[model samples]
Target chain A: MQVEGLSINLATIREQCGFAEAVDVCLKHGITAIAPWRDQVAAIGLDEAARIVHSNGLKLTGLCRGGFFPAADALGREKALDDNRRAIDEAAALGADCLVLVVGGLPDGSKDIDRARRMVEEGIAAVLPHARAAQVPLAIEPLHPMYAADRACVNTLGQALDICEALGAGVGVAIDVYHVWWDPDLAKQIARAGRMKAILAHHICDWLVPTKDMLTDRGMMGDGVIDLKGIRGMIEAAGFLGAQEVEIFSADNWWKRPAEEVIATCVERFRSCC
Target chain B: MQVEGLSINLATIREQCGFAEAVDVCLKHGITAIAPWRDQVAAIGLDEAARIVHSNGLKLTGLCRGGFFPAADALGREKALDDNRRAIDEAAALGADCLVLVVGGLPDGSKDIDRARRMVEEGIAAVLPHARAAQVPLAIEPLHPMYAADRACVNTLGQALDICEALGAGVGVAIDVYHVWWDPDLAKQIARAGRMKAILAHHICDWLVPTKDMLTDRGMMGDGVIDLKGIRGMIEAAGFLGAQEVEIFSADNWWKRPAEEVIATCVERFRSCC
Candidate 1:
């Protein structure tokens, strides 16, 4: 009873399970594809994690993640690049589809987002050679504008596409529903991403009204206002029928639930809502 | 000295004082321009509010606000239009430059934002005749993307401008720095807004990092990451020499302060930062 086209990003269950248990839950529920964060992989040991993923014949939709490109100084940026190179190596080992990037925002006490954006581009360019060499595609995840000051400065799919166009190759975009569902130009940009062949991953989570917390209050598929099926249809039309990776970061609600229950709910919601 | 080009949106001191006291405080500080919410005006009684403004020769930058078009049924929509018509009359009475529109979000149990946006446009179109007769312009204030679901579906200047272009004369936009400072196309859109002569109001408030509350925690002009002077430069270059209205919605901080202190601070900040 393999769910034909669904994937679970491990962050959806990060509080309840680690890398290995998450995979086990996904497998138990017929979800064979998973995306795991770097810390989770590191905690379980990359070699052991890779062995488990391979032995189970699991699809690693993406490795989450590697991009905090902006830094206050050149030395700090070099550190970030070195870490990203390590992440690429890990992605290569896991045979993950792509390395998802949450590109950094403003440096300490600086108001210059343009400079921060430039830094993100340059950081990605610096790592392009290594990522390409590792056969890993870099997927820039454009975060919502609310996170513009503290998190990813890359805040739109079109902006991400512009970056991808600037850098020759080995770069793409991860279309996350929570970050981009409200975009007026969503269909146009998703289509543009399709034409550019840059839609490396698709992530799902609803945007709850009265979104209680700015960062950790993501909703499950059907509980909020996002037109999940509609967006999935758009993505499918755009030529990427990849798994819709579920990534929820709900602190007060979903995170408190048992891992099994969470996975079960994800499966149910995916079938019924998403 | 009278601060040459500054306006006070009364919401900044909403928690501390009501309409008349707020106006007195503004006049005492030499800020003769103000934007008052309908509730504030109703509390003071519109006739008295109008008298105060007339006697003091105050400029009504805008009346805050009108537009909540999306409703669950036809009756609800008609009610919204009726309310918007009343708001138009109030703006006319106050000699306000425009009636700001915080266009409504999706209706209850409905995730159809396109329908909601269409409702907003239709609502505006329905009210345009009344607004024109009353001699009050309509200023569509494009809210931040975070408010797209509950507060406003119109989340970008470009989107608002598109509506204005479609609606034709007596319709424009209120460019709030807090709402639109993060836009990658902000400069270009502001320029476009200027080209169309659609820039009606320029609201100033910094976007604080770690914005504690999405609705109320806006920063002062010099406090946050928004390039206030730069944005002001853009607005001015776009031929909008109108007052830069101070509109901070700080629940725990600014609202708790005395009205005098807030007005004084606004005057000082408008000179130094904005």
Candidate 2:
């Protein structure tokens, strides 16, 4: 009953369980693959988290994040780079497929998105060597345009692929359905990414019709109007045969449910909708 | 002192005033140009609205909207087309520059964005002859990515331009700063639009950092983090010399203000930020 090529990003059950408990829930549901956020790993202590992950023979699809490059000052930028290096190390320790990056947005009190974008590229370049040294590929997750101003300025698969091309190897893209479902150039970009061999990860989540919040009102699969299976087909056709990581950040609804119920819903939705 | 090359989309003060009062406020502030929604026009009666525009020699920058093409059935599609024709007639009656189209998203209970997009294109195509006969150009306003699910599937300038190219003449794009500020391909697409002469309108609004609501949490020009002057410069450079229409949908903030105050602030923002 193992669900091969299916991974659960712990954020889906963030409100219901901690890192260890979330993993246990995933295991019980025959989902051996998982992606954990840095905070989740830190909560359990990275050493214990790594021990548990290793002992369970679980597939670490990806580490939750390692980017926030844009900053108001050079010192802040250096701090972000240092943090990214550490994130790469953590991903390496966990034997993750890649260190996914939610590249930072405009620095506080700044209006120049172009400058922020340049900072993102530079930050990625600065950390590329460290990531490569740790044998961890940096996966740039281009967030939805909604998050471009405050979360991640890298807002398109094409833009992320451009960054990957500029940085050469050791860099690629994390194709998240929630972030990119609206892209008019989606099929073209996926084809381009395939040609460049730059697709690193495929994350899944539904976009609610009435998305209540800008940050955390993510819909679980089958609950919203996303063509989840269609997007997966596109990603698969683009040469990424990796796990489809379910990563919902629903604060009001799904997050309040029990961990077992949440996992069960995810499994059912994965089978039916996705 | 009239602010040249600036227009106010009346939705900015929709919560405070009707069409006639809003027009009076704009005239008082020496902003001769305005774009009113269909509801606002209906409130005052189209004949009165047209008479006011003619008497005051006011410039109707563009009509608020005329698209929501996707439907659950053929009857819905036909109804949408008929409505679009009416919108075109209204725009022509007002002597507006174009009929702005906020192309509809997925049909109810459906996850097929591609089909929705096709419906939009087909809907526009169906209405093109009527628009042409009415002497009203159709301006496809690519809404923000957040609205792609329920409001609009066309979410980028390039995508809008593609539709324009396919549809031939009497069709173009409304480059809204709020919707497209985050697009990395913006400059390239604007330049491409210019080459094709597909740039019909330039809408302006700030994207607040913490956008509270997906539909109505738009920010005023200087209050938010958008590079208004920067984007305006891009559009101007791309040969679009139309009025920079201020279109904010701030339900909690600006909407609560006096209509005159909102118009005055829009004038000030246009001079300073834009």
Candidate 3:
């Protein structure tokens, strides 16, 4: 009864469950793969979290996030790098497949996105060696262009791949359907990621037609316009057979539902739609 | 004294004025250039609108807009093409420089963006003859990727240019700062557009950091993160010296203000920021 290719990014059920409870809920549903946020792991203590993950033989598809590289000053940039190093350590301890990086956007009151982009590249190159030493691959999660100003400047699969190619080893990309499904160059870039051997993780979620909130209003898989099956085919063709991690930041809808119901829906959608 | 290089997209003050009234406000502020929507022209009758434009000696930067090509069925697509033809005629009547095309997104219940894009191309091809005959240029306004599902599938300058190259002349691009500011490949593509002589209309608007709503909530010129002067410089360097048409769709902020104040602010911001 195991859910073969389905993994739950803990954020999908973070509203209803903590690290331990969320794992318990996933275990109840026969989903043995997960990607947990750093705060969720910290709340239960990394040791206990690691124990739970190891005891259940859970697959840590990825650690939720790590990068926010661009900063207004050098001290702030150094602080981000230090924080990223800690995140890498935590990912290594959790036996994660990769550490997902939502690279930061423009510095406060700054209008130059080009400069911010350069800082992201430099920050990644700086910490990449540590990530390599820790045996944890860094997955650059290219956020949608909507988030290009405040959240993450890297907004395309091809852009992320460029950074990956520049950094050489210990770096790749996390292909999330919600952020990239709208890209015209999606198929071409996905193929390019495959050829570069840089696709680390695949995340699944739907983009609602009337996306009410810019940050939170993500739809559950099969509820929105994304061609999940088609994208999966492209990813598979690109030679990435990893779990399709379900990550929904639905503040109004999914977050309001019971964790059990949410997991069940994800399971149902994985079978029927995705 | 006419505002030398500034133009007002009537939608900026849409909630405040009708077609004739909007033109009056623009003329009163010494803003002789304006872009009016099809509905606005229809409100006062096209003949009357044309009479006003000719009498006042106003420059019509573009007629807003014409493309919503992708549809659920063939009949729907034909209807869209027919509508676009009417829009072109409207632009011709207004003596507008170009008919801006906001190429439509996925059809209802459809998930294939590639197919939607093809429909957009075919839809443009269907209308090209009419547009050419009417002597109205087609400016494909590549909307932000956020609108790719429900508004426009053409979400990048490069993508729009590719379609223009395939279709040949009478079709170019409307470079909107709000849409393309986040693009990493923006500079390169703008240069390419220059090389192809494809830059038609240059639209100016800022992208708010915490963009509250996807459709509305657009920032006025100096109010947000977009480097207006920098982008304008790029456009100018790329051989486009068209008026920077001010287009804001803020349901809450600018729309609630008096049309005079909005026009004054646009004039001020165009001077200082852009």
lDDT of residue B59 for candidate 3? 94
Per model, the share of native interface contacts recovered reads 0.56, 0.93, 0.94
Provide per-model DockQ scores.
0.75, 0.87, 0.92
Tens digits of lDDT, candidate 1, A238-267 = 999899999999999999999999999999
- State the lDDT at B175 in candidate 2: 88
DockQ of 3: 0.92
Instruction: Please state every model's RMSD to the true fold in angstroms.
Output: 1.0, 1.2, 0.7
Worst 10 residues of 1 chain B by lDDT: B251-260
Candidate 3 collision pairs: none
Tens digits of lDDT, candidate 3, A56-168? 99999999899999999999999999999999999999999999999999899999999999999999999999999999999999999999998899999999999999999
- The DockQ leader among the candidates is 3
The TM-scores of all predictions, comma-separated, are 0.99, 0.98, 0.99
For model 3, the docking class works out as: high
Write model 2 residue lDDT over A188-233, tens digit each, in one string.
9999999999988899988887888888889989888888888888
- The residue-by-residue lDDT of candidate 2 on B1-274, one tens digit each, is 7778989999999889888888888988999999999999999999999999999999988998999999999999999999999999999999999999999999999988998999999999999999999989999999889999889999999889899999999999998889999888888999999998888899998988788888889988998899888888888898989899999999898999898888888888888888
Q: Chain A: TM-score in each candidate? A: 0.99, 0.98, 0.99
Where model 1 places Cα greater than 4 Å from the true spot, the runs are none
Q: In model 2, what is the error at residue B71, expressed in angstroms?
A: 1.2
Cα RMSD for candidate 3?
0.7
